[model samples]
Target: MSSLALHVADKRPEDPADLTGFYAGLLAVLNDAALNHHGWTGSVVADLGEIGGYVYMKIRPGEGDEPFATIEDLRAFRKRQAEEARRTEEASKQARLI
Candidate 1:
């Protein structure tokens, strides 16, 4: 199951640094939610937007149908994919040499 977490900033800042700070604070709140929320295992998809002079963030558990993937999991998957691609390329080169 997936859950959506929403956060709204009281005021939108004109300065980029203030916007960054707002996002940072929002992420902290979302991280806390991820820690406390049941069925939320830290993997999330989040989006930020502004409307009516307010900044809003929406976060949800990533891909509800599948098991969540952590940063380590994604890194390992990327490594494996790269390795497989390298092996395939090497095999192609050997075949060409034949």
Candidate 2:
């Protein structure tokens, strides 16, 4: 339904830094963007689901997606909608050292 960032690591970043809630602080900027651009907040989901690092981003700032309210409307419009799979674009992942 959405893209995810995987942190392949032996430990979480903030733990090594040894500062209280350090990773959360680092994620604040991302949280801001996620809150503004996307309809749902990932950190809240993370808290409920006991997971982390999930978020939403506005890749197309100028382009707006078709709005759908009804269930049939949702079923019809499928370029990108919340929690819906993409038929046009295949799933993929590319790693970076960063």
- Runs in model 2 deviating more than 4 A are 1-18, 42-98
lDDT string for model 2 (1-98, tens) is 43342121123344455432433443444445444555423432121111364322212111244321222322233223433444323333222322
Clashing pairs in 1: none
Candidate 1 structure quality by residue, lDDT tens digits, 56-76? 655566554544434344345
Best by lDDT: 1
TM-score of 1: 0.49
What is the RMSD of candidate 2?
14.5
Error of 1 at 12 (Å): 1.8
RMSD in Å for all candidates: 10.3, 14.5
Candidates in order have lDDT scores of 0.60, 0.32
Point out the worst 10-residue segment of candidate 2 by lDDT: 54-63
Q: What is the lDDT of residue 2 in candidate 2?
A: 38
